[model samples]
Target: MPTSRFEVLGAGAFPMLVHGALILLLTGSIIGSLRKIPADAYGRFAADVVAWGKAKRLVFVVFAGLGLYVAVMPVIGYTSSTFLFLITLLVTLAPKTRTALVVALVLALVFSFGLNWLFAEVFNVFLPRGN
Candidate 1:
């Protein structure tokens, strides 16, 4: 007998269903895999994980780009920051060609500034206009 109103979870709430489902799933998995053979040896599972492999430079650049985007967003506004980020990603990932460049530029502009305009006009929402 609980006195609090929130103590009674009404209807099919998330915690009521999700938590039980997760518990059942984990318990079933644990029971089923009790005698199963392991794929990788326990100690060497992380041995090859440290190596960055061939795509190290690309991975690092993308990570840095994301960090820079977040850092510059407040200072340069969301539109400009997103434009730079999108342009960089599009240029780096797409094939090297004039058509690719034009498409990247157009997409970057459309997604960044165009979306900004849409939000401002249609949704009546204002974004940070830089510092």
Candidate 2:
């Protein structure tokens, strides 16, 4: 609901401003930490960066999947989208084992349907529906 460039506040403005401030604080903290590292210990920073690089692909995939989930929720409805997202995320992150897979599937179903039921029946706050 922002109108003018000079406008300081509006609906959603507070959360947006807080999010930006948090990002800035995190960036500042990372910079400060890196600065405190001695020049001779630069290898430590490089090693950390390398470790992050190795995991960057998985991170990107998870974020991209989340974006797709948000975009499709209105079309597919909340229950289906939530179930799919949870299943995919759980399988992707969990250890590769039969027990782990079974547990992930069970958890995904419970969370997706249980939360939907709770919201609709108890809280009386129905999420968006495709039908």
Q: Clash number for every model?
A: 0, 0
Clashing pairs in 2: none
Model 1: per-residue Cα lDDT over 51-106, one tens digit each: 54444768877888999999998899989999999999989988999999999999
Clashing pairs in 1: none
Score every model by TM-score. Answer: 0.58, 0.60
Q: What are the per-residue Cα lDDT tens digits for candidate 2 across 81-100?
A: 98999999999989999999
Q: For model 1, what is the error of residue 65's alpha carbon versus the real structure, in angstroms, after optimal superposition? A: 5.9
Candidate 2 displacement at residue 112 in angstroms: 1.0
